[model samples]
Target: MTPLIQRILLATDGSAYAARAEGYALFLASTWGAGLDVLSVLEFPPGMNPAYPINDVYLGQLRKEADRHLGRLADRASQIGLSVRKQVEIGIPSEKIIAVAREHGDDLVVVGTHGRTGLEHVLLGSTAERVIRGAPCPVLAVRGIKAEAVESAAASVPLAVRRMLVPIDFSDCSLDALEYAVQVAKQLDAAVTILYIMEPVAYGLDFTLSHPSELEAKRARLGDRLRDLTAAVTGCGLQADEVLRGGLPADSILDYAHSQAVDLIVMGTHGRRGISHLVNGSVTEAVLRRADCPVLTVRSPKFAPDHRRVIRKPEPAASSG
Candidate 1:
């Protein structure tokens, strides 16, 4: 089978968390024998005048520092037998990272999130979140590890994909993520645990819920559906298991993953933006922020595949203005 991930882009800010992300990127690239790109962006403060002499000097210094950091990372990757290209760009960090991934048609993007929450996260928006929302392909968001843990495991720790957890909601986006997860499982000879969360509903205080028998019947039906979904995966010659839980989706998924010691989490995001996303919080984003393992987020495809087309069409010539 062809490799699912061919080109990987790893964006770094020279932080400890980013270094951990780089470790995962390097390991994956070596395992897949894929090309890797190390990208670093120099971000300037908003409202800063670039034309000012002092500002220009500061910008040049920042660029040089970024270059040096990327150069060293590239050298490290090479020393470990992974070939990588280094890139340095000046722009908004997340925007430039996404732009580079699109321009290169990279199959996967790896980034680190600091896992800030509440008012802090609101005031300082997450770059990893924006990149995942806008990336053209799949994104792997690595959560930051504590300093002491990094100190102990930084050198030899590798991301183990022996067990993978995938949360499914029967949405096209979730199914797409499942398919990708199955492919990765096949490659890694890993097992996949599919989870379906039935969110608890609270009726009005005056209303009473259904009978126990009726709830059991509903749970049985959902279990059947989950089994049906896993049939394809099992038929693909990989071990698969299904679990149905009742609770908050994100919390349930994370709890299951931690309890099972899952090495990876593959899930889908609807990619909602702005007010819509704020109002309807994203389960995927929540999981990404707190997942102990690396979370791979695949956005829903805009267009379905055309299976009827067997032959390729020639490109039209461009007209010169």
Candidate 2:
């Protein structure tokens, strides 16, 4: 199978959240043998004029601090024997992150969220939300855990994203996300769970699905599709499963992810050519902000496959005995 990530860009500040993101960046780089680019953006003061002479000293000090954070990331990557490049920039945080991604052709961009749910941060216009919305490559928004948990999770050597959850609505973009998730699973040796939530009917007609025959028919069809997807994942020789639930899409996704101990949540950023709007009312962003683990949002495949790499064939003959 072809690897999905070759170059990763990590955006950080000196916060605990960024530190967790750095751990993920290093883990992915080591797993994929990818190069890492660590970036820190020192935002210009809002009302201060750059022409003021005293501001130069202030800006210089901030630059040094940003570089300090970037340096830590570089040292961590080096300890893993991964190639890394570091940079410090002065600009808007999200804009600088997107610019670095475009300039460096990063396959993935990793950023961090600052709260328990991370939604409040996004609603208040946090850099993480903007980066997730505007980044040119797939963005992984990792929410901050408690300090002790953060230290334990980040300090685990040879970190692994052991189980991944992908919530799909069957749109083309969503299916693409599944493909991307499968590629990631192949690389990380992770288990994949494909979840489909059959939302309750609209207009407050909650009991409409209570009709036995009608609900049964729809469930049958959705089951078939979900099982087909599950088969595809298992065919890749990776551990895989399918889940069917009924609730609001975002709620169901978050609930299952938390209960299943998912290490990552992979999703599509948008929906079928403007019909539904990314899983009905920005569900991707909702889950992206609230998910416990890092959420990977993909609009399409992020990396070019290496053609020289040989494919792995299924080992069906072992079962013949």
Candidate 3:
């Protein structure tokens, strides 16, 4: 069978977190015998003196430094018997990364996130987050790891996607994630666990007695759906299971990952932005920030115009005034 991922793009900034991402990219590229591209974006320095005559010279120096860094990363990949193409561009990191990934039609874009939260994350937005939101294909965001840990792990053996978790919300994106997870599981001989989280329903005091029966019915219905989904995965020759939890989606996902010692998380992102994103937030993003394992986020192709036209329902027109 043909490999699911043919090419991988790894974005780095010469940071420790980027190094960890590089490790995963190398492991996957070698495992799949896929082509690899290493990219580094050189952001123009902020607060530089625009009036200074030597500004251009400083920019040249920065470019040279970035090239050298990328070259060294390429050398490391070569030492591991993996050929890689190195690229350096000057622009906003996130925008440049997305543009390159789109231009090359990469199957997957891999990058590292610092996992910052609250004021820190707000003030210093994550490049990984932006890339995941806008990339044309799936993205794998690796959390930051210590240098010592990375070194030790690299010396020992290549990483494996042994146990994967997929959180589903019955959306097209979630289904796409599940499909990708199953494909990966098939390739790696891994087990997959599909998790569905339902919010607790609040009922009026008058309906208190009947709520228990209603809840039981809902659970039974969900169980049926879960069984169907698991059956489809098992048909693909994979070991699969399903979990139903009641709580906040992100919290439930994280708790399950920790309790199960999951190695990887494959989830879907709605790619919401601006006001809508602010209001609804994103469970995937929350899990990306807090989860201990790597998160592979698949943007639903159903959102594309071509796919949308197939599945979208017609809207009612307004009456003429």
Candidate 4:
């Protein structure tokens, strides 16, 4: 199977961000020769229960509006030469989107975030954030869109995305992310820049005075590992580079990307559990918050084989004979 997204679900709430997502979705669909499925979730009207006293007319009107929204998105996607499909569902937006994506075998889910931070995200509780946490596949969150003005602002992004920036920590997850990034860069006929951040904690005051020498040794070792890391990709006719930087992991990553004006940031989420993930938020989240460009997050897989060497016993009698 093609690892790149072949079936994409673009969820819209008639928001401006949704519209921008649709435009990006179209571009991705065309570039990857994928199918586009646009979905709009109809929220339950305030304090209205489906089980309560009926009003067919009102419900029908709501459904009609939902249909109208989905239809417009479908038409627009079609105009962009994408094979499009759409559906409107009523209930919680994130739940319905997750359901539809799973039911339709969507490889990627595209949703819009309002770019809420601090108190705003807390007050409103972002649906995009919920979906990202709960999604079965990779989720692309595009913030900064209002629901009402989607159609009017569909403009082309003139920049051609050619370089992909990938941050690696040499963990299994980071390695997997690097692999995915290399594959994507190869597909786009672009180059890959692998960034390794030397965390601040790795160099505390308590550390030895010869820490600089130790760091240099470690850098050389990491360079060798990076060489091995890029071997397969380079062999497959892709260009790759390795960069080492020191500082906060996420900040360093974002800074490097901005300095290089990279088009995309591809990183992996270890998808850590509970307190660990909460205490040490994923770099994916940090990049999502700070990046001026697009970010693609690949979730790491978790299957390993057991390979223990078994020592054989010699026949003592035979040896003596």
Q: lDDT per prediction?
A: 0.79, 0.79, 0.78, 0.69
Worst 10 residues of 4 by lDDT: 303-312
1-321 in candidate 2: lDDT tens per residue? 355788999888766656677778887888889999988887875677765888888779988888887777777678879998988887788899999999998999988877334343453267887887788888888776666676786556755789999898887778878888888888888999999988765543564435678789989999988888888789868999999999878889999988989989999988632323443447887786677788998964564645321222224455564
lDDT comparing candidate 1 with the true structure: 0.79
Q: Candidate 1: TM-score?
A: 0.84
Residue-level lDDT tens digits of model 1 in 1-321: 346778899998876656678888988898888899999888876687877999889889988888888888888788878888898887788899999998987889998886222222231258888988899988988877765677767766566689999898776678778877877787789999999987775564779876779889989998987887677688878899899999878889999999999999998886223343475468887787678888988883222243221112225579899
Rank list by TM-score: 2, 1, 3, 4
TM-score-wise, the better of 1 and 4 is 1
Cα RMSD for predicted model 3:
5.3
TM-score of 4: 0.78
Per-residue CA lDDT of candidate 3, range 1-321, in tens? 446787899998776556668888988888778789999887755576633768767767877887888888788888878878888887778899999998887889998885222222331258888998899888999887765576776677668889999988776668778877777787788999999987656555776544678889989999988888898888767899999999877788999999999989999887323343465467888888787888999983322222212112225578998
User: What is residue 197's positional error in candidate 2, in angstroms?
Assistant: 0.3
Q: What is the lDDT of residue 148 in candidate 1?
A: 60
- In the range 137-232, model 4's lDDT, one tens digit per residue, is 777666544445554455544335688888877665666767667656765788888888766533347774556678689889988776666665
